[model samples]
Target chain A: MADDSTSNTPRDHGDKTIEFSGLVCPVPLQDYPNIILGHGGGGKLSADLVQHVFLPAFQNDHLAVLGDSAVFQLAGVQLAGQRLAMSTDSYVVRPLFFPGGSIGDLVVNGTVNDLAMSGATPLYLTAAFILEEGFPIAQLKRIADAMGAAARRAGVAIISGDTKVVERGHGDGCYINTAGVGIVPDGIDIAPNHTRPGDVVILSGTLGDHGMAIMSVREGLEFDAEIRSDSAPLADMVAGIIQVCPDVHTLRDPTRGGLSASLNEIAAASGCGIVIDETRLPIHPTVQSACEILGFDPLLVANEGKLVCMVPAESADAVLNAIRSDKHGSGAAIIGRVVADHPGVVVAKTAIGASRVVVAPIGEQLPRIC
Target chain B: MADDSTSNTPRDHGDKTIEFSGLVCPVPLQDYPNIILGHGGGGKLSADLVQHVFLPAFQNDHLAVLGDSAVFQLAGVQLAGQRLAMSTDSYVVRPLFFPGGSIGDLVVNGTVNDLAMSGATPLYLTAAFILEEGFPIAQLKRIADAMGAAARRAGVAIISGDTKVVERGHGDGCYINTAGVGIVPDGIDIAPNHTRPGDVVILSGTLGDHGMAIMSVREGLEFDAEIRSDSAPLADMVAGIIQVCPDVHTLRDPTRGGLSASLNEIAAASGCGIVIDETRLPIHPTVQSACEILGFDPLLVANEGKLVCMVPAESADAVLNAIRSDKHGSGAAIIGRVVADHPGVVVAKTAIGASRVVVAPIGEQLPRIC
Candidate 1:
């Protein structure tokens, strides 16, 4: 089962197909050279690592969807049609506490957002902590309190947990893993593969705030107007949108790899093209300045609280109104649309009226930004 | 919010109550000093850590049950009575591979057995891995293969997963976190609090095999017949027993802290006393010899595949017969009985007809055995 599909073509350009024969090792381990922290940053390198290593090893139908959460039907003994969704993520963001949010809330909101992306009302979460020995008890308490508050605010219960303490030098301060189980409301089927050509893509709010916020603290960058992390739970916002329109095609949170990586993934999964107008893309002024100063692309930076959705053109206005009603989605905008041409490519219309292909970053622009 | 209950009394004797007037720091952080690996060893220290730290922070109704897995009812939109159970564990064993199994199968079986202890059939598991950079892909492949095989054998699916790579020196080769969701059958109310004074305690198989096996390999000890880890899945065996005796009070897989910790925890949770006959306690010759030579108590050594159940004396014979029918429980024995004399105490009746209190270990004899 050595499916060397990735080895044959090291790079994928939208719907275009390229192949090379007579070279068994098109991309060997040597080509990867070594796994950098960027491989875990949820960027192009992260996708490649999962595609080449994890997917082939744990091949399954549920995992094939590559959605933020894996949704399936669990036929109970006494009842049927039990649609449940499960997702897991590990948080290793440096500087446990940041300007607006810490790793604790990030872990809770990250997993919750993943479940909400699948049109599920995030229900229960299980947390696991890997702490290094000598980590202050007071700091652990602060993180736990933050997580508890986040869970309470998001309307999910922290049902069960496990804590493991590693040797002093073997681990960083702490790494948290949160796995969630949510109930996908009946009649709602949202997945990346469901995107269609005439779908209108809507973004919940601004981008690059979360990444730039973390970087400001990590790199000691001071700004007159501080850029705070966009780290908030999106389940209520998603539920609001679904209430207005249940036929939405896909919902994804622009996390580690940001909008570029998320849109590319959706395009590839649906075998369709995505075209967006750069002028409509929402960006806070401070975040824009920070990205420019740091030499980072706003499209490739991470966002913790925003979501990208592709809905039918007919229901786009109603869906946008519903999202705009939420405090977290006040800056919602229709940034893009799906197209039939160019299959899996994402094209951005620049302000000068020229179009550019949006490529996924091969590695993380900021490691451990989460 | 500061529950410093562990500080007052450093040690707990069976059926005794000792109180100190008002020492704010009963067991001050400085008393035990630094955090040791034994604190995560599932012994008294581990229990104390959970009691003084985790419970106070993430306090909720579900976690108070203190069962291997939390059993909760999820009301379905289409149908009702969707009883579900979930549990999470992180594996940080030093060596990835050992005699009977590796960390891969240990994670799978450990989680499955946990769900089984709550009388639930584990259905789905989500795996998250934290890999150290420079770790060999071949080794990861072997672990994944073992995990896939184990999941298949146990009749569970690996639905979704996440992978994160840490810098080389910051992490061990790999640490895995697995959280499972299972379905609890109707009318099955298995819990630690359900235990009664007259309940019969049954040991599924011999004790200390797993811990001894790991110690032998870690210490480079050899024997005529190699002692292997008793790491096997007990879901099927548990199902078998439930079929015959659905009134089982409690089921526990004695890992990390072994029978002593399991029995003590049950006694404390159920607020009852337990009395086990030494003559009836099952112990393999090799394991007994190894424990004796190593100056370790078999009751405090870990066992990955064994189980301890508290059933009514009337149904004890039937449950034993059912467990014996399974290959993993061929050596099942009725080793102990619950008592009403003293609450929250465990007494062992020796061959000489005298009884001695079985105190829980303050720390683990063998750390990271699971």
Candidate 2:
């Protein structure tokens, strides 16, 4: 069986030498003899699979960028001036319903957030559903209703969709894949590779709330205070930030592998080091207590309605203020800085003023939490 | 249990009065208390689910058009001159590999054909994969390789993709959802509602090959002649047809529920009657015999690479010639015509000179045939 250990020790694959190009798969195959749940985990195994298998198969200039969304200019002179962004994400969160959200709203907000990360104004979405044969119609109705409401809230239309039913045993209740298309406004180019030394990393709100909420339901564990998912759309907040800081280096949602994964990815792509103060990281009291009880690290837990922005130090205060003004960004804080030392590494400064390397999870810490 | 009968008797829902607007769910719910295999069969049940459940939830002008794709303009003055087409489909074919194609190629061609039906030049495709835990990596690689090859053949790029793994028994080996975006060329407007009276309906090639190819492998049935799937890309052929007949009214690929369903959909959408000569359909001899032995109606069996075109009488010859000249359209034939009488119904003239109403199948004839 694949290792289920939740160790924080950095793995060998978490190095700067591993890039998108010229990846050899046999080494990773030796580590993973068969597909595991961690392959879907947004961690080292997931990165290895994507870099070695998918990237090589579907290699292209746009995909090589590996941003949250693929932004490109539509061919032909008619659409030459307009750059469009397209993104697809499959939502397979178990338990369907959580404290604050369900798969329905999660899918819409997830794809919308993906487009927003690229500085695009999400316009349309396509929802494709894979349903189990015996799944309840009433639940399906509720899910669809939530999706429609979420789309309206995000100011985008669910213009196209598809449905397929698999045998009861062949599928979960339902899996939704929402693919979104948006228009990238002029004079805005945001990507992970844009991160540079002296960039300030600002995080939007409390970590571990979303992941902990799902775990609460799955494990039937309740905290002293209720922990609800922080799943909300972020396009408006992204627009606010871009208005104030157009030259923002990178924007990412701390989702699957949480803040640590996003930080490591940006550092590797931009050849910089990210250093965050553990004391400055935002955490909800209930979420923090729950993580402590569950022996989980808040830095490695997923957050649906959060963003990590990297901007030049000169504009850090402006970007931070812009994020703080949005409804979803009230708890935003400057938690980290990009530096020239230790490229492709993320370090945390503890309360004792000692630094420790914060490694991305090797596999899923909480399976299907997103 | 829900009805499994593949009766061709006209159901109550197959009438012109059943429009997309103001649809009530209780009526269809009575017919199907729960989703069955037929809900994904692309037959009357599938149509009812979409019209009652999905359409009502995601109501919009673009979605109401109900063409193979949703075509619209981006919301800005910058892209006012360009019209874009977007489509999504999930491929759940059994026995991933069939005689002439696999789920990989089927997914790529399926979305490409969907965009082509809107008279759009397919550009970029996003593939989302739902893989079952413990699935073979070699098979995954093979599928990815096939997808890349097929995308290259269709002249489109697989720019963005997402992968998620479900626990064993929660999924089949793999299910792929492909969402595509394409550009609708100038001066070309194609939609199911665009079919007008006196338009000539043309069949691109033989039917039932793709469906039978899967059945033969799935059931371990052998025939004298192998029935290879007629799975090929139709974008280039569609482009050629547009070059010859830019005013083509409607173009549809008779997938899932096949030619009869496509005809019924167009007839209802256009408020026109369709009459086809049964003897004129181009069916491969092996596929015809297989359908006969399997007690399947060829009219409702799926075709992957074929197209049904509706053109004005003046442009019929040019369109037919263009289709015939293409390699995939070698067996193209003029099969039917639109009539002013009996709107929302299809009639077939038997080889014995008798006329009979051709009703869409009520449910699935062969499940999981893509």
Q: Would candidate 2 be rated incorrect, acceptable, medium or high by CAPRI criteria?
A: acceptable
Any runs in candidate 1 off by more than 4 Å, and if so which?
A: A1-34, A76-80, B1-35, B76-80
**Clash number for each model:** 3, 0
Predicted candidate 1 versus true structure: per-residue lDDT over A1-370, tens digit per residue: 1643224223333344322121122222222434566667776667766777767766788887889999978754544555889999988888999989999899899999999999999989898888887666667778888998899989998888887788878888788999999999879999999999999999999999999999999889999999899999999999999998999999999998899999988988898999999999999999999998889999999999999999999999999999999989999999989999888888999999999888766666887786
Residue-wise C-alpha lDDT for candidate 2, range B22-58, written one tens digit per residue: 3222233224445677778888878777787877877
DockQ of each: 0.46, 0.48
Q: What is the TM-score of chain B alone in each candidate?
A: 0.91, 0.92
Enumerate residue pairs that collide in model 2: none
User: What is the TM-score of model 2 when looking only at chain B?
Assistant: 0.92
What candidate 2 gets wrong by more than 4 Å, as runs, is A1-31, B1-31
CA-lDDT, candidates in order:
0.84, 0.87
Top candidate by TM-score: 2
